[model samples]
Target: MSETRVHRADVKTAHQDLHSERGALRGEHPGRSRNPLIKVVDLAWLEFEKPDLDRAEVFARDFGFQIAARTDRELWLRGTFAGSPCMVIRRGRTSRFIGPAFHAPERADLDRLARATGTCVRDTDVPGGGAAVDLLDPSGFPVRVVDCDRALSALPEQRPLLLNSGTDHRRTNATQRPPREPSRIQRLGHVVLETRLFARALDWYLDTLGMIVSDFLFLDGRRDRGPTMAFIRCDRGSVPADHHTLAMHLGPGTGYVHSAYQVTDLDSIAAGGEYLAERGYRRSWGIGRHIQGSQLFDYWRDPDRLMLEHFADGDLFSCDVEPGWAPMSTSGLAQWGPPATRDFLGAGPSPQRIRDVIEALRGDNEMDLTRLLGLLKAANS
Candidate 1:
């Protein structure tokens, strides 16, 4: 498939627009693959390695995940939703993200994928025992496609609260007091990563997993260079899916940025923020509505310094909706809330980050002088 041709007028308009519009200008890279090996159903879970399993489990509970199963070597976390676990943490020498696992709709897809990729389908020891086909993405991130035989039954529901808006008041005699407690996490929504090989990695996901672009963000005055960031979702035909199951951006570093989990509503996010703050966990950024996915998000740092997000009320879309394009800027990140924090942006200069930039510029990857300058300009914008 060829890249979608965008009009000059659309590019000019998108430069000033923060909201995504269908049929907007895109880069030279195509938004999707004409034919893919297998279309993944949804994101299953993320894998991580942490030195202190005890500390990780404590934070996981506070962050609204239930312990599905725990062992001396491993810890599995789950949400209230009826499905697989949300995350798996293994005891390791240091804390780091391992990779992500996607759910395959059928068992045969695993065999097909294994055959196509020349890899064997192996049984996984996760909570809901299943078989998985493992592969590596263009950016060298470990990716697993699993056909889970068993599914976890849904936990007790955490009902949403009735509200009294400006015009409509649903609650008359009942007072509004959301308890200060851990937000009941519903499920894993999406994960964001930064990679030096953005174009190649974007194509790999679209081609390998049958994912499609929901929105594309390009740096201002550099539309010709194509999109530097993409919010990608699964193509579930007529069924609606989350706006972004995965988001990837071009950056000096190649690793996990953050992972988001769905909560009940705005109250859950706010109250959860208070709960975490009281427990001495740092709030990274959020309590804001994002412009891309339209999710009301609140971010927090885990004991290992990994960023996790509590989000609610995100946009969903059917496969028929084409990708939208917009200019990338710090101001365009949210619809309403406090300004994006420097910590959240990774803007604060650190020795390691500086070293990554220097190495990325010197390496053979996409990071060059112009791209680096454009990223700096976008961050400041």
Candidate 2:
């Protein structure tokens, strides 16, 4: 008997010429600055306000984070890495994303930034003993820069499983079944945000944190409108860094989009998704490869409806790589995977979202009529 075979249409041929043309634009914007206060090392953690701490804690544990410290009013969660606390949930009457904390390259960088930004440098009382300079970005999000002095005992690390391929098998007489246990999260990778001021926010991030743009996405057929979205990375000279430590896209409102944590590999993501499913968590999107940073991704919503992502095998770029330019389109967001859903696009045709759009249109912000239409077109494309 012959085996059943299935074939799909070739998409590469359709986009081959466009890919070649865009490839030529790579490295056009290295985005290295001659003088800045300090280069941001990495994203340290995020803070959120949740109404129910107990319910939030359950979701955190199932999402593969261990509780580092807990109080009646606050909870600190940490990954397997030595970083003491990667997340903080504070009890509040209403739930919302507070902001993110970033690590500077050095202890002195904290002082430098404090003076430059005219903000006071004070000691942090959080789980990690550190001094922080807290300030708000142009988009009204709280930003914390800290120099950690707390010592952390490293946790056990989970390694990726070796796989046997069709042509060359790596395992001999060994059957593999990934455990249903929670996939260990290695560390915090990045956070994405939506802002009403695209150019201002982009400039502020670049100038203040010394970050470089890894890629830029503009509205289709509107190159002159400039890039509405950017994948920005820290300027670690000669040292390889994740393709993007922070990403921002122009939208009708300013708020947190999602945060990504690094996992072991593809197996961990799939198995972890299963664990989340068994625990009755909602999946937002993914189990696919992204085009910009090239990370295998899986997204989920926590108990408080905050979006989080587990990713692995992402691209790393040295400071020399120039930023790539591309058009923003729904179909171009992923390399291969299930088609993006409206929920994933943050475009669910809900009444609240439509009201938000109406509010933005009525106000004088970046998401003007033209920009809103452009974004709608891009999402539908």
Candidate 3:
């Protein structure tokens, strides 16, 4: 007999509700083609256009990234990972998420992608010298896949300390006080976005990147309308991958929702939150375990108000794992945490958000008034 793990009493109900409502629907496309032009191995970095490079650099440093390289017009930031630069911030008049760079499984994949997409393979101008092919996603997000043979030297990392628990004690007479410093990020875990056409965008990613859906969340009583959000992961064959390397949600605005970076463990997330809070950085939501990926998470706003998350203890899945389906609800997002904040819900009042609402109402898209009202009601409840 196998032992079953139990959750805390406070979060047990929500966790059980999620499991109970996880319908028989697996989000995979049964007829999805087995071969993709190119397979992406991992996420390389994200590109951002911001008005102020100086402010962005400060925030990046405080967020635990070391300056990899910098120029008057651009900045490169790296994590503890061997990747030369995990993030790029370019000077622009307006702040927005440009896109992400994925790692091509092989150098030959670059030529394959370029030829298939009718794009020319070119030398990457990013910090890492490599070959790359850039393509636009269905949602018009920039997607770059790089094939590189070189990487910057890895940075030093603080290994997780031995922990003591009720039944097992790995530490004897030693106190635990995680340093009140920026949590050292291991690498970019995932990025999420909201798109007006969810199904189209979802298919585009699955067909193009050879990614698989890990889970799907549909509106209650409207499963026929399809999933409103999907957690997708790279198809790494027998090797396990993060539950979701990327996710997309149906919303009025087609913009970046947030990007998550991996930290060492729960202590790093909590202590890092304290460091960020002390520096007057805004925390969106956190110190909670998510229902989907089971990651311990903390969210914060960058200087540009872009949401970024520090997560640890995330679930990993093999290719054989089938997608799980559940209803989209605020209670289902987290197993336990402070109630989902408006900022995290994308319901916070903003000029751009207001414009998006107007555009969605006037346009025939997924974010119609009926669905919008349903989301609002869910958030309120």
TM-scores for every predicted model:
0.94, 0.91, 0.91
Q: Can you tell me which runs of candidate 2 are displaced by over 4 Å?
A: 1-32
Error of 3 at 86 (Å): 1.5
For model 3, the stretches where C-alpha displacement exceeds 4 angstroms are 1-20, 23-33
Q: Report the lDDT tens digits of candidate 2 across residue range 1-381.
A: 323211111222222233313522433433445576788888888989999999998888899888889999999888888865888889999888999898887788988998899998999867868889998888889999887888466788777888878988888887777898887888889999998877888887888889988778888887766788988998887788998999999998789999999989999999999999998889998889998888999999987778999999998876766666788998887889888888889987788678778888887667888888899999999
Which scores higher on TM-score, 2 or 3?
Answer: 3
| Clashing residue pairs in candidate 2 (N, C-alpha, C atoms within 3 angstroms) | 27-322
Model 2 residue 256 CA deviation in Å: 0.9
Question: What C-alpha lDDT values do all the predictions have?
Answer: 0.90, 0.83, 0.83
lDDT of 3 at 43: 88
Candidate 1 deviant stretches above 4 angstroms: 1-18, 26-28
lDDT of 2 at 80: 87
Native-vs-model 3 lDDT? 0.83
Worst 10 residues of 1 by lDDT: 1-10
What's the TM for model 3? 0.91
Candidate 1: C-alpha RMSD to true structure equals 4.1
TM-score ranking of the models: 1, 3, 2
lDDT of 1 by residue, 1-381 (tens): 333334434543452354564455434556789999999979999999999999998999898999999999999999999999999999999999999999998999998899999999999987869999999998889999998889999997668999888989798988888999999999999999999999999999998899998889998989888899999999898798998999999999999999999999999999989999999999999789999988999999998899999999998877766677788999989999999999999998999899999999999899999999999999999
